[model samples]
Target chain A: MTAGPVLKGAADRVLAAPAAPRRKGHPGAYLRWLLLFAGGLIMVAPLVWMLSASFKFSYELYDLNLIPVEPTLRNYEKVLGDPRFLRWFGNSFLIATIVTMSNLFFDSLVGYTLCKFRFPGRTLIFIAILSTLMIPTEMLVIPWYVMSQKFGWLDSYWGIMFPGMMTAFGTFLMKQFFESVPDDFLEAARIDGLNEFQIWWSVAMPLVRPALAALAIFVFLGNWTAFLWPLIVTNSVEMYTIPVGLKTFAVEQNVDWEMVMTGAAIATLPTLVIFLIFQRFIIRGVVMAGLKG
Target chain B: MADLALHGLTKTFGKTKVLHGIDLAVQDGEFVVFVGPSGCGKSTTLRIIAGLEDATAGTVEIGGRVVNNLEPKDRDIAMVFQNYALYPHMTVRKNIGFGLRTSRLSRAEKAARIAEVAGVLGMTDLLDRRPSQLSGGQRQRVAIGRAMVRDPKVFLFDEPLSNLDAQLRTQMRLEIKKLHKQVGTTIIFVTHDQVEAMTLADRIVIMKDGVIQQVGTPSEVFNAPANVFVARFIGAPAMNLLPGSWREGGVALDMGGQIALPGRQLADGTRVDLGIRPTDLAISADGAGQITGAITLVEPLGAESMLYIDAGGVEIIAACPGRTAPDPGQQIRLSADPEALHLFDATTGEALR
Candidate 1:
């Protein structure tokens, strides 16, 4: 008796070797890299120009050159010698720090409550918060100005800091991140004998560190460069933040290109420091939120 | 250690009742397991005892004190969740010691206790590793170690071993049993696997839908199941049931045979379903047995082979020696002792004593 031809054919087919691998690096891949590089250069050109102008003499300001022929520190000296420049820097740092801290505390607390706790009107409250996100910041400025004036908060740090103390976007981000921290962890923490606030502070909060870092860095940068509201609200140079003060300095000096560029270059330092400190968290948070969305 | 009791416990989630008035009393230091299929409310009952969930009605007593209103932290209980819920940011040692952060124990005492638990779980070398760095079984051990570090009045395990692979599940089941012996703490475990329930439980609580069908020792539940569901559920390969009607001294099987039940006093013509375990039916050599049928298929399980026999239109499974199982299409005679037969009501599916 012989093994059948059909069985032999199937065995031969099953034992056959695999096909060759595909080649790498097609033309479309090179095109994509070229396009991305061009887009990056376009985005970074203005920053390079500003740094170069700050170093060059005022005669070379309009040369369209990225690198300075003879870099000088005189513009920095003139900008720093102005006492009000330091005061404005201090004010901006103080308000940004306070606002970021407030947002971190209030936003995460509200987010935790909204996400973890089951109660009546939760969806309604969340919708209300979400609705506020649709309204532009320009539209809220008037109402905020009226409320600040009614409460005698004009020309004060509180007036500028209150609008951003707890943002709808931050709350939404925190809530989304909190969704990833399982209810099992919270229940286990409870069974482990931690109170509700402690559980939120220790167990829930630590798990959303990425979101918190993203929110902190975002809020700090937003407030650091804030101009419209602060300019409108503060009547004295003593109370002005960096952006408002720099605008006034430019106008007073009749657009001294070197001086203005020097101040702008120096003003970018804190934000650069912040980005360096939390760059990884920001990227991860964006990817996480993007995937979730 | 504490004796826990639930009096008329029920849970409702937005009008869908998950537990229907569960009432059970567990002795101090006893190991009780709740076994049921998914969505059967076994885990809900366990959570209510742990104070992770609030019962819709009734009170939970821990060591004779009502804990219905207490928070989970104040309930003096600990739970091992199914996913092992270890904090990803913390080391195994830190995860175990997290429960002691609010304790009145001195820092040194807490460290000593965590070290002791790690030693008990044979995980001292893995203590510095995070949960993300550990394997499934190792993470399960860390979860158990975390619960052990607390030394609470009662330990609630909600399908803790379900996450492990088959071999690891058996190993962890034995480890849990050994841990229970060493600590002698009151434990309430929940699982869907009947084998886990049978091997590790002092008393198994069998549940269906939202109600407990029976509560008994492993031997008792296996020997005399409370209903047809339990009869089919507790054994491997399940008990084979044949629909039939009862006569005074015998059951007229729906497939055309009579089984003489010598001691039953069932009413004549009562509709019933007769059940017999595959292991209880043996092949007869002389071809004169209570039932005879043609073999349809044979399943080899190493030591024993299961023969699927078709008698009339009904298919029945019987276990025979693996080396000597008759080939398919052969006629075989199988005999079962009368005492081994179980009779259940055809309509209600409840067993008839």
Candidate 2:
């Protein structure tokens, strides 16, 4: 209670101080904050409503109430207990984890190589990798499916993971960060008797921790939320990832809004947890990119 | 400790050739400094010796073994970089002991070695601190300590003191010189500062445009410069050059005056460039020498004054007293002892001994 009074007194003094420079300047600051608040609320409305619906009954899904008139835990219970739903979540969890690990290692390794080494056609190779980012995912699905079929990877985790195990965007991001690890540090490591691979793993990896963190979060979320490719590639319902499995809850005549919303809410949890844990690195990476641009 | 020898070492980067066959021999426990202007390839030569970069054509022998194809670690050399490449994530103790990781020493032995190196660098108290927590000079000592703990055959320094501010640079120079005496390892230090070369090196190797210009001790390079470039590059305020044509017993300067040398004689009308150190060439109130000029500017360096004087339509630097600075645009006569005058070939720039 005393702490509350002290905080209020300090805040009052801060506002009443005529020496406060922000008071004399910053015209229309309140208006800017008001606009930002409105825009943020609009953007967040859908997610908030979906979360509210996850706690509602199937009949109350269309009520348009921000809060359920009578809340129920039945949808979560139904989504959690179903063996097929549990299988789909496990599949997504395995795929995203494996893909995130592969992207972190291989993308960073390729980036370190391209950035540090003086090789013929290095620029050409980098440009080629970047060019793949421009190609629409729709155009590559057929080739991916054919490759998966030929390799007998269809109806398996490999089919869902092979396309995004190492991403060009991730490679590009890691390369930009690794390029800044000074030649001196690497040379010092080499002189310290570390081989090239050890030098990369030991010296170079620690220097680009933020970039690695940012890339891991992005790759994990992207693979987790993926829908269309998993829908097309996997023939078995057991192989369906979260997004495709959530779609399976929507039938043509009898769509269970409550079950779908519950599955969607469950899928969103991991991404929210990851974002919270690594938000600092993500924001720093974006700010650094902005400054460079 | 072991000697280092570089034989016919050359380096090329595509169309640009950086080092043109450098050759030098460093004695055991000797401190050799490579001094030169930017792009002169001194650092490139040092890197080649450390096995950081492969030479285009020659072999580097350290301790009677040719290490041309060996990796940097196998070559048994440690380097302190200009930026002090200490691992920021590690404590000073860890960064110094990083090289010892690959060694077969036990954990207790490694800690003892780290403690020993930290003690030697007078940084025992700083070992627990991270590099970012230390001052610039402390970080420098840690870098030196890191190299020292390796006990390599040689220690290489690549412009290490260039990152320190002026006062810290001088202090670190002294520390490095003292450390060299304490460790007694063969050291190859590369820098562009002549003062650093003069103060710390047993032998200074001067380079320009990918070629070694001269190699000598501090006194020899300063007093008996090998060429016009060496003469000017070695000293602060630079050596003054006066255009003259050689004749019997004298040089007839282009300024319609003659500088008399009683015993020395050259071919009549042979073009020569008269080189005089600023400390040797001074402002004279009593017409001591034939050279005359109007003072252009005065630079007071506390101990001595440098007067930029215009002699015969050419601006030349001359030395003067610290307390008595000749006013700018004032007429003065320039004088120098005949024994201190350096004459170089006008065409070749080589000293005309």
Query: lDDT, candidate 2, residue B144?
Result: 90
Give lDDT tens digits, candidate 2, residues A161-243: 99998998888888877756778888999999999999999888887777788888888989999988999999898999999
| Model 2: residues with Cα > 4 Å off, grouped in runs | A1-42, A287-293
Number of the top-ranking candidate, with lDDT as the measure? 1
Whole-model lDDT values for every prediction: 0.88, 0.87
True contacts kept of each: 0.64, 0.60
Compute the lDDT for candidate 2.
0.87
DockQ of 2: 0.35
- Across B1-353, the per-residue lDDT of candidate 2 in tens digits comes to 89999998899988899999888999999999999999999999989988888999989999999999998999889999988888877889899999998999999999999999898889989888987788889999989999999898999999999888899999999999998988899999999999999999999999998899999999999989899999999998788888899876878889767887676768989999988888888666676767888888999988788888888898788777789887898988877888999888899999987
lDDT (Cα, 0-100) at B341 in candidate 1: 91
